[model samples]
Target: MPQDRTLLYAGRGFEVAHVRLHAPQGPVWSDLYTVASPRVVFPIGRTRLDVRSGDDTWLTDALTAIRFGDATAYRLRPETAAVRHSLVVSGHASVGPTHGASTTGVSVCLMTPQALYRMHAARRQLPDTDGTQAATLVASLVAYLAGAPHQAPWHGAVARARQLLLSEGSGPGTRVLSLDELAEAVSRSPFHLARRFRQQTGLSLHQYRQHLRLASAMERLADGERDLAGLAHDLGYCSQSHLGAVFRQAVGVTLGDARRVLGPAGTGASASARI
Candidate 1:
């Protein structure tokens, strides 16, 4: 059986897919995106991949990060991995890849292991709708790869507040924290925390939590879960209808439509499934 394609996060402007490919007898080519969207691919193993767009092709190794923009179409051919895990992001700002002297259209940049670890750590700390932090991390990674100046620093208090929020809302049966509680945890007044959080992450704490809830619900639904009421209750929505309203607003599609797109559980591959 193929490995499951898990959508780690998805929101209005960005989405992330965790892809694992099982044993391959030969180089495997997979269609990545049809529409023009900026994408970053981080291969988690010592594998070689050729990213192709039209006649332009770039070669990337496991440790390198590749960025592409204005690509009409793209495909990935992975070599030499029996089981490979890669994190791919779409719809973020496009940065040019570091290219070899001979290769054109793709740039390869060395990413430090520590930086990669911090990126994932920060991602795991963010609520689902808080794509801003994730995007920032990616952009920073790109800048670092391109030998550019880093972005402004995140305030220490706000960073701690974000971690506290993530701890509260990330696990199963976890309850979200009230703004007052979060503020107290970070030693800030609620008003101050809210203001700083918005400035740092581009979303209020409440909005971020809601995005996390909706994202959790969407993952369950995509995994072939039924019982909307149970999902709503588990995720702390007031009611099933409330979940539906929020889902439609955040996803720009009805739950039914999303389910259809996701297909029947255990039978269909996710939209981001590796071919």
Candidate 2:
């Protein structure tokens, strides 16, 4: 079995990963991922996926899109078949999948599967384009995936606050606003805003900001940014060690291990490939 993982796009409240696994009548492959927030998974080929958490298990068909809510630990196993898949992880405020569609806190949606396959093809063709074009395509796709209809009131103050945080938390050099500042902007008391924010979004403001910073760091790392100290400083970390500690805690892997698994950064031509 030969497997590869690539970072396709990372911005603000979300990041997408392209993963390929080639297992031809080989041993079953399983991996554990720490899910801090909601994520959606799309299998590109005819492959079976078994997702488990503790006693809960879900068997999914090929080419189906699955959305999972905040899970502490998740185990993913693939059948004895080759497969290529895309996974998108986003902050809680962006995509929240309710239960009943699948297992608890997991939702299954099937809308425009053809469009998704076309997007996958476009990602394969992205390497041929310039950096600006690739970035734009990625952003567009992310926006589409995150563009689920709002289940809550659109004009609600909490919604506006969430949007403000998401917009400001994207990219590097972001400084999370204070509680007072956020409350003032949203015209709510600090305590009320904090409580409402947490109620609406599964994550607190500080936790959401950390998630964004980590996502940005992952993108820079994939683009061949290797200077840990510089990357830390750019991300507004006090020091490289601080960034390392947070990465290890949140991702369950050290920076060195991630770099080794990702291999060297590829040229734009090698950005996308099949198993």
Candidate 3:
């Protein structure tokens, strides 16, 4: 696979890089790779990473970020063909202990647009920041994610249903599914699916779908998507203004502001496109 990684800044105890991983033409899974230092990775846009750690495997998309301790080894396969972008921060002092690490010292966190916005702002300042300020900004994000709430476990039909939503949601043309449609796909009654989905994910199907739609919109905007109308339509919004309304409600910024501040300066956008 062809890859491009550019070092954006290197401060005293920390460094930041923008990495782009293109889809491979041959084998689906790439060869194993190891991290020499503790680092946190934020996936952008429609990026989909299927991570293999030890005997376990899981997927990380626009809705998630992953942290790995020194010497951690893993393999990756792209779940989508879109070129994946990620922001990598390494050599931060907060590397001592990270939240939600499994036996391999790799932890996954669910990310929000607000969190991503904060990170993007910090990252955009790296070039002008002194080493101390740089480390502080990057470590702040790590600390914030460390304190976030853990996800409730989802199993059986609920798990499958969640996957279906994520898979369908993380793309250019997102497919909307009603409760009945999702229930049918998961082979469960509508009531059972709805009730169990909320029980496991703490969100109704409608709410979760909305979360995904907004996430997808954020991902695209961060990737320098300027066509509000096109983006809104592709993500199932009624119109550009409708997307702006919900975006402001959820992200606390107008679409134009988000684009100017968060989109494609150097760092990858937040996770949600893959959520």
Top model number, TM-score: 3
Per-residue lDDT of model 3, residues 11-39, tens digit only? 66777888888886532888889888888
Candidate 3 deviation (Cα RMSD):
5.0
Candidate 3 residue-pair clash tally: 4
TM-score of each: 0.47, 0.45, 0.80
Which 10 residues in a row give candidate 1 its minimum summed lDDT? 266-275
lDDT of 1 by residue, 1-275 (tens): 15556786676466767777664655767755553565666655444555666665555544446655545466667655566666677775444444332133444443443444434433343334345555556556555655622111224667677556544644446666888888888899999999987775556777666655555565566456777788778777777788888877766666665555443432222222211
Q: What C-alpha lDDT values do all the predictions have?
A: 0.56, 0.56, 0.69
On lDDT, the stronger of 2 and 3 is 3
If the candidates were sorted by their TM-score against the true structure, best first, what order would they fall in? 3, 1, 2
What TM-score does prediction 1 earn? 0.47
Best by lDDT: 3
**What residue pairs are clashing in model 3?**
62-271, 62-272, 62-274, 63-272
Query: Which regions of candidate 1 are displaced past 4 Å?
Result: 1-155, 170-174, 265-275
Shift in Å, residue 70, candidate 1: 17
Worst 10 residues of 3 by lDDT: 266-275
**What does the lDDT read for residue 139 in candidate 3?**
78
